[model samples]
Target: MENEQIKTIFEKEGITSEIQCPKAFEISEKYGVSKMEIARYCNKNNIKIRACQLGCFK
Candidate 1:
């Protein structure tokens, strides 16, 4: 999915924080997107990530 599409998904799904969102697994499951892709988008978009079990940022 495109970055804007991912952001739209985030907004539509009410996902405001990675800490609360759990490595965006919900997005992965709901949208059939990989966490790695979401991580890339998050990183490129300057979105703050915290408590990621997958350590996508690190």
Candidate 2:
């Protein structure tokens, strides 16, 4: 998906500065995107990932 589309979804979901790991996974599955892609987007956009189940983001 395009970055703008993801941004819209994020806005709709109220994901501004941060998002939980499970919530990210839900967005990934719901949008047919990879978790890594989401991570990259978050990183590029300065959005923090919190409560990572795998301790990857922390």
Candidate 3:
């Protein structure tokens, strides 16, 4: 998915700076995108994903 699309989803879902475990899984399932991909995107864009198993951005 495009970065703008991803950002839109995050914004629509109220996932601003941080995404918790449940929200992460929810977005993964809801958007048909993997948790790793979301985590990676957030990490690359300087957003924080709390308590993710993939260890987002330190």
Candidate 4:
């Protein structure tokens, strides 16, 4: 989803009220994996990820 568009949806759900989801890092940690592992896996899978750089979830 477009970042801004996602933010609005999150706000309605009382998540950020300004931004979408706290951040990717926070999400990854919950999955029991380092952020680096996530990046590497994404690359290996040919997902074309260019570093999460979100620094929001982890």
TM-score (all chains, Cα) for each model: 0.72, 0.84, 0.77, 0.39
- C-alpha positional error of residue 23 in candidate 2 after TM-score superposition, expressed in Å: 0.3
Candidate achieving the largest TM-score: 2
Which is the leading candidate under lDDT?
2
Report the C-alpha lDDT of model 3 over 1-58, residue by residue, as the tens digit.
Answer: 7677788899999887888877888888899877767867787788877775655324
The CA lDDT of each predicted structure is 0.72, 0.85, 0.78, 0.40
Pairs that collide in candidate 2 are none
Residue-by-residue lDDT tens digits, candidate 1, 1-58: 7888888987887666553446377668889888778878877777766766655544
Residue 11 miss distance in model 2 (angstroms): 0.8
Ranking by TM-score: 2, 3, 1, 4
Ranking by lDDT: 2, 3, 1, 4
Summed backbone clashes in each candidate are 0, 0, 0, 7
Task: Give one digit per residue, the lDDT tens place, for model 2 in 7-55.
Answer: 8889988999999999998988888867877888899899999889876
- Higher-ranked by TM-score: 2 or 4: 2
The residue ranges of model 4 lying beyond 4 angstroms of the native Cα positions read 1-23, 54-58
Error of 3 at 13 (Å): 0.5
Candidate 1 global Cα RMSD: 2.3
